[model samples]
Target: MYVAVKGGEKAIANAHALLAQRGRGDAGSERIGYAQVRDQMGVLVARVMAEGSLYDPDLAAKALLQSQGDVLEAVTLMRSYRTTLPRFGVTEALDTAGLASERRVSATFKDIPGGQQLGATFDYTHRLLADELTTPELPTDPLTPPSGDDAMPRVTDLLGVDALIEPDRPDDWTDPDPADLTREPTVFPMSRAERLQALSRGDEGFLLALGYSTQRGYGNNHPFAGEVRVGEVEVEFEAPELGMAIPIGRIELTECQMVNQFVGSADQAPQFTRGYGLVFGRSERKAMSMSLVDRALRAEEFSERRVSPAQDEEFVIAHADNVQAAGFVEHLKLPHYVDFQGELVLIRQLHREFEERVAAARAEGDARAERRTKKEDSHA
Candidate 1:
């Protein structure tokens, strides 16, 4: 009782053609160039790089152009392209302490070693759209660094002097490289490295919502922004031929450290717990949200009961990819006539059977009442 529909191939091809035409805009208008996207849409390219987990700005820009400014699609395109590239040796871990910082702030202390520098942020800007942006004008002044040493001591390190912050635990420096979630399947009870990797490429909006929920008392951690820094760090890789680590390139990064209040447990002393976030480019919002979610997921380690969505690692990480979520939801538009017809047939059969049963019950009741009335008449 099912019929299959066919002949979607030609339609699909035509749809794709139309999509390409629309993506390019009208023939009368000037086409958007790759250079324009790379240079002008710097923030969008940065987002693609961060979410795609790739550092190639040129390729990210190309993906942006191809996707018609759809950030998630651009990220998906970049991630797909990354799989085609040759595998290279792992890079040495970066030292944030040595970063040439463009922006650094500490909410814990008003007077840190390096005074707070609010650089290129829209936090204080008015929300209204500006008319000048329709025809943009470049800034007249050249960029200049604020007066501060490049080596700004970490706020956490300052607190460590008083033993107020948790001390760093020594670990094996030669331990095997952590599992790459991109290549390997994600297993339950993931390591901190794996968890952080997932958050680095997670959907910004999803993380933002979870972070907001935590702040709204769903899983309040009383988080304080220990430090937020944006800067460039050199990427070094070990060269077997050179017998030393060589600087490959420099990448911009945004890092956030959240200090949360923790009460003493039976085995542990009362101290502030830390949640860390580091992402590609100047992604302050994503970094802050990642830190909040990171802290929420550590509820088990802290021996706290998981009572909110933010604390559910499986749920959060599984659905954090915008690409995956969109694909699954949008797949509903595909042809499902045959499957739906089968369900329709089953539903009709069930309705018929129900009606038959009801009719039989009614007939039986009527016969019994008629028989009782005849018996009463004979008795009269």
Candidate 2:
């Protein structure tokens, strides 16, 4: 017997109730609080903050709890909240040169001015956990804590070893005002700012996979993480009223510098060109993936021929975000009966025409057969 599914409203209500139950888990256990989720599940929160483009740790933690630990869903929730928020003012363009760095490492040199600080990393740690985590009464200290440093020299400063690299901005270099992605529609042949803005909110898995493809000899730009730094930077904006640049607020950021070696052309000598990445919050993975992909996209500028999926800016940046890709993909499940019905009608018409042609041919054969039989009967 077919049971009619008549609980659309009731089903939604019941589903919500079930979600609440599942989120709460078994009745007597400690409920997951926002702070607990933020502090304990910081890595997950970082990912959400990176993609969501919001820096609020507490809200991101709440989203993680509400999502039941789905990172992408948590990001989506934060993004939705961000969308509804009113724009108060734009922050000043941050000077990363002045960043109060916690972790700073460069691959180009062995040891530079502001020495290596592997701050708050899971890099050297064994995957196995200690017994304390299972029965923790109080918060434990991380294996590495950030060394508070306000002034740190960039790794690029070390490149002065050779006179080949010059810190000179090209003459007549026009740095145009960046297009606001949230308010403006993205046009073809995107700017660097537009590309980075799109990628900041891009899917981690997709971007990571594309980046991996390039590293696996898909596109032959010799790439390295030249510098990767995580820290806080002051945001500054030009104030016309004050007639001077003013500090707005401090925001935490992760910056990646990928240096790709290019062969000397006839006009220029073989030099190391740069790929830059900056993202909100402490998102090293995202920032690193972004830098790799950014350099890959700039294959033309690097004078390196493009051969990989990562090199295709349109394809990579366009489809990298799950928010956009997921919405379009899942929207297929929504009601499209009208369009389906139209296709059905078109197919039926073609079938009718085909049947008519077959029927006409059969009738012609039957008539010819009858004439032959009459002639044979007359002869007999």
Candidate 3:
């Protein structure tokens, strides 16, 4: 036991030292700065913020540096830091219609208002990695503001005008007080707000897998990208003392609107259903995956059969958190001597019982043979 404890302590100390050395990289090379990570690796910082449920880019960058660029670790760090900060107030619902878009596109329509502005996207780039990017000189271009009208109407709204899609109902907005999952524990039959909050902070890779599963006929709902917009939107807070809303600041957002096909049910007519996704920063993949999952979770509302894991709310939300999943999975590597000893004791008892039963059966057989021999001798 002393050896086990000493060995474990020494091993952990060595592991930590190795990790620190690896995180610093080559001694001859310059160490990576948090500023460089924040500015150059904006996408990674954005991911940490989204998954961590915190919007501070600087904090996210710090977390990334501390975690050695492991996104899940960075997210955990940010989340831990977030708990120390006090809440000011909740922001009012954002108006995406008035957003100053950097990039906007729709797969369902060929041309829409504001046109398809594919801004700073990797969509057209080749998959090959360019080693030149290590110390590359970037080209400087004049900032060209988006031309035409700034108002980009939602594709779903256009469909709604033609009665091709379900109209946005007032009942959807009837939830006065939404549950805060951070403070309160998640209960069964979660509200839409709670589900969205969970998904926004969920691990992107897990959501991507589940979303892909839906596309592969698991919970097939022919979904199309109605609209994907990435841009800056104004955030406003309503103060009770002021009795009015006040603009706080602007935040970059990625919003996705997915139109899913739904057949006519007994209570409702056939119409295109909607799945919404909104997240911090420019995350198209995450937004799209989130929308697919959002629709899948609403199978009951659509009167569709829940035949897939995506439709299982308990499974999806419970396992969506990487921190929680990692803790439970990694805990297996810890000491389990007591647990194993209990199992060992039970196995020995079972083995002994089996041997005793075998010995008793053999003795009984010998006695029967002896009795048969005695009867034969008496007859002779």
Candidate 4:
């Protein structure tokens, strides 16, 4: 079905062969193994996985290696490969409240229920580039975790106790049938679930810019980082044969909940509204930015005036995917000889017409001068 066109087939094959060779840097350098890349370059692989919408670390590592460390290319490779794999079923909604958090912090509160645990974070460090990869001091004994159940309650739970922030879900909530973006053609006015899915897979830099715009009076979202948690949560799935949900495995996830002050609508009483973000792996910054933009897009729901690009749902969701954007932009590299020729022909014709108009105007002015001279001579 995917047979190559006859013209330049050998050239195309050779180009790809050369590209594969170049993936291994300069001569005499040892080739980087997939294991080393998967382990050492875990963060980059996680980002690729997030955008790619796939969870396989090995495939992401291979893609990264093949693409020569290009993130977008790796994501494209992962996305393309995903289409070939068959989907079994969707997983049940994850319970993030029971997450075994390694890093949890609350910017809104001085004291929280579990006490702030600053686990494995670069937030406090003065970011200076290291001149050398110095050996880390090895601990004599393995560090023991605090003796207790690791499942800590979310900060929003505490806020709900005093009725400070609005509940994330209504008391009489039922799971709505969500759309599969991979299959369905996008329709405008997408559901909150769809918007969240798109934004989660969106380019981080794009969302960060939009989120920053909101903070700078574009969307009027003065958001407080209620809580940011990085932890491992169990993923569950319901099997038809089993007839019950079972925990399949655990995945590291980062969640951000933003609290924003909202003026009460005519029907509803005044209360703090919340924005939520959840992403694969330890991506705190992405989670925070996502939460801000997510709330801003809900301007209509909150009955707030939408005044910024971030608040425009269609614009945000449509342009979110980097691969789509790159395809639209990079396609210019292909042959456009006919299109270019058409433009040149039109431009040249327009120039000739302009010159002719100028010449006609000049001739008309000369005739008028001659008529005026003759009239003046007759009067004298």
lDDT top scorer: 3
Better of 2 and 3 by lDDT: 3
Give all TM-scores, in the order shown: 0.88, 0.81, 0.87, 0.92
lDDT-sorted candidate list, best first: 3, 4, 1, 2
TM-score between model 4 and native: 0.92
User: Tens digit of lDDT per residue, candidate 1, span 180-281?
Assistant: 888999898887778989999999999999998998987847899999989889999999899999999999899998988888689978888888899988
* Cα lDDT of model 2 by residue, 103-143, tens digit: 88887777666667787788887989677767335348544
Q: Encode model 3's per-residue lDDT on 65-180: one tens digit a residue.
A: 98998888899898899999999878888888777778888999998866787777889989898777765454597444355444577788889888898766544667467678
Q: How well does candidate 3 match the true structure in TM-score terms? A: 0.87
In the range 164-212, model 4's lDDT, one tens digit per residue, is: 7788887898799777888899999998899999888888888999999
lDDT for position 82 in model 3: 92
Q: How does residue 308 of candidate 4 score in lDDT? A: 91
lDDT of each: 0.85, 0.78, 0.87, 0.86
Worst 10 residues of 1 by lDDT: 1-10
- Residue 259's C-alpha lDDT in candidate 4? 89
The whole-model C-alpha lDDT of candidate 3 against the native structure comes to 0.87
RMSD of each: 3.5, 5.5, 3.8, 2.8
> What is the clash count of model 1?
0
Off by over 4 Å in 4: 1-7, 138-151, 369-380
Alpha-carbon shift of residue 147 in model 4 (angstroms) = 7.0
